[model samples]
Target: MKNLLVILFSQALVNNFMLARILGTCPFIGVSQQVETATGMSLAVVFVMTMASAISWLVQHLILNPLNMGYLQTVAFILVIAALVQLIEMLLKKNSPGLYKALGIYLPLITTNCAVLGVAIVNIGAGYSFVESAVSGAAGGLGWGLAIIVFAAIRERQQLAPIPKAMQGFPLALVTTGLLAMAFLGFSGFNVAKFVGM
Candidate 1:
């Protein structure tokens, strides 16, 4: 219980996917122009990240590590994530048409999102158990969701503000993200290694 809490808090805030790790900056900037789109993207990412983490951990520990195939980690994890994204897209479309309409487009895009890969790689790098990996992955997804939502809100408001032609779209969004990253750095001391009894 304590370790799970540590993983949740550390990944969500101290090691946030966008502000701290800088993963998934593509969607974080691109799809965040509108709140609704950003929300959809976030939901897809949350599902993908959690599922990817769990599957990757299983593959790594139960299959690759024991077989002396650790070098294949990257390739295997990427394939798993892609498959999971596709499965989720199909499931959502079948079970919930409304959610499918809302988040379907983002599903294919998330297959390439670095944040998903980052979480899986980070889990292996940290040598986390299956439970820790799942907790951290979910927390990371939540953090990514929080980041995109905040960015969307900021961008929506910025749309009304006067801006220079040179710094109009992506440049301005990047600058905003930079500031958010700077603020997030303040929480870095909440290190997971220490907090999670590593």
Candidate 2:
């Protein structure tokens, strides 16, 4: 339980997806002009990451590890994530038209989100248990969601504020990301392994 808490906090705040990991910068800059869009993207990313991690974990432990086929790990995991995202997109379209509309084409882009793949690879590298992997995956998603939402909020507000012509849009968003990354550096001392007696 304590270890779980540590992983959650570490991923969600100490090492955020955007602020710390620097993953998924495309959407972070391209579609984050609005809070609603940011939130929708975040949720889609969360679902993808969680499912990808779980599926990847199962593949690694049950199929890859047993068959000694670790070389195909990346290919297998990516395939699974892609298929899962498609399924999710279909489910959302069928069950919740409003959410599907809000998500729009972003659901398909989840396949390319490095953050989702990062979580799956990280789980394997960290040698996390099933529960730990799930926790970390969710935490990664939460961290991503929080970072994008915060960034979107800031950028939205910044639109009305004065700014140099040269430092607008992409440039300004990059600067914001760099500063946020520096802030997250303050949590580097947090150690989940130590706290959990690993």
Candidate 3:
């Protein structure tokens, strides 16, 4: 339990996919115009990331290792992630047309979102078991969700805040993202494992 908690904290905050590790910047900026869309995207990412990690872990240990085809990890993981994203896309389109439309190209882009792949690779590299890999992936997704939602809120508010014309869009968003990344950096080397009694 302590180990799980530590991993959760470390991945979600200390090693945030967006803020700290600097992965998945496309949707972080593109889908962040509105909190509603960002939240939708976040939930989709969380589900996909969690499932992808779990499935990829199984493939790595059960198939790749047994066949001594470890070199195919990236290709295997990509296929897995792509398949999972397609399933999600279908489900969302059938059940939630509003959010499905809101997500636009970003939904498919989740497959290419390096953060999803990064978490899976990190899980294998870290030698985390199935449960740990799932947790790490979920945490990574939650971290991404948190960052995008917060950023979306700020950007929405910025509409009314009278900002200088030069620093209106991307410039301000970049500045905000940099500051958020710096803030997450404060968690660096904080010894979360020690605190969690790991």
Best prediction by lDDT: 3
Off by over 4 Å in 1: 94-106, 190-198
Give per-residue CA lDDT, model 1, range 1-198, as digits (tens): 877888898899988988988899877877787888788778878888998999999999999989999999999999999998888888878887776675545568788999999999999999889989998899999999998998899999999999999999988988999988888888887666676676
lDDT of 1: 0.87
The deviation in Å at residue 40 for candidate 1 is 1.4
Task: Report the candidate with higher lDDT, 2 versus 3.
Answer: 3
Tens-place lDDT per residue, model 2, 69-137, is: 999999998898899889988888898787778766677878888888889999999999988998899
Lowest summed lDDT across 10 adjacent residues in model 2 is found at 98-107
In order of appearance, the predictions have TM-scores of 0.89, 0.90, 0.97
Q: Rate the local accuracy (lDDT) of all candidates.
A: 0.87, 0.86, 0.94
TM for candidate 3 is 0.97
Q: How do the candidates rank by TM-score, highest first?
A: 3, 2, 1
Candidate 1, 80: how far from true, in Å?
0.7
lDDT at 115, model 1: 94
